[model samples]
Target: MNDTVPPPEVIYVDTHKVACNGGGGALGHPLVYIELGAEGTAECGYCDRKFVHKDHAHEYHDPSPRPEGEH
Candidate 1:
């Protein structure tokens, strides 16, 4: 039995900071704000949704690691 779970939903944002409400109306969790900080990536604690900055989108896709501040 090799059941694989899919990755969490990803959202591309223009800013480094964002707020998430789960997007499920009454079923959604409380609104929480996240800061991407230096890494340029943040994930929602309530929904595990990944928020990636548009400028750092390449880091999320490319597995190879490169120099920092290059992206």
Candidate 2:
């Protein structure tokens, strides 16, 4: 069986700046603020969650549904 883990979740935003807390609550990680690069993309250091600018979000095809309350 393949042991590789699937990629972390991806979230799209309209702005270059965003904050992540691994979804908050008991399962959450520490809060972190990230700024997307000129390419309009960034990844959370703690959770590895990808943040993509809305304009570029379409470039990636994420079959998974977005989490509730995420942009």
Candidate 3:
């Protein structure tokens, strides 16, 4: 068995308030609202997906590399 661990998915959100339902599909879960506190990041309790504030995306493990001042 492969012991390598895959990286967690990171979503950059513009607003502090966000709703997650496992992306809404066959593997989706109940709709839930998540708030990004002062830390500027939140993880879905059901899916474990990481939501990072767009302004602080660089601070997290974001796959996309964005230049300064650019969303």
Candidate 4:
């Protein structure tokens, strides 16, 4: 059993909506838009990169409750 823990690739985002295309170039995929939603994080469908909001940097493990008045 491999107990190695690979470091998560986290991209801090300011906006709730983010577009990802696997960073383009050689290893890239079709563009897709990811919405952070209430969790304040979204993962790319192609590359599986984790997108985390700046506000939720500390509580990355346990996502905080969504802010009031947000859908």
Please list the C-alpha lDDT of all candidates, in the order they appear: 0.79, 0.83, 0.82, 0.76
Off by over 4 Å in 1: 1-6, 62-71
Task: State TM-scores per candidate.
Answer: 0.72, 0.70, 0.72, 0.70
Please provide, for model 4 over 1-71, each residue's C-alpha lDDT reduced to its tens digit, 9 standing for 90 to 100: 86744333568888898999888989889999999968788788778778888887676862334467652
| Residue range 11-70, candidate 2, lDDT tens digits | 779999999999999988998899999888888888888888999876766556677886
Weakest 10 consecutive residues, lDDT, candidate 4? 62-71
Error of 1 at 69 (Å): 30
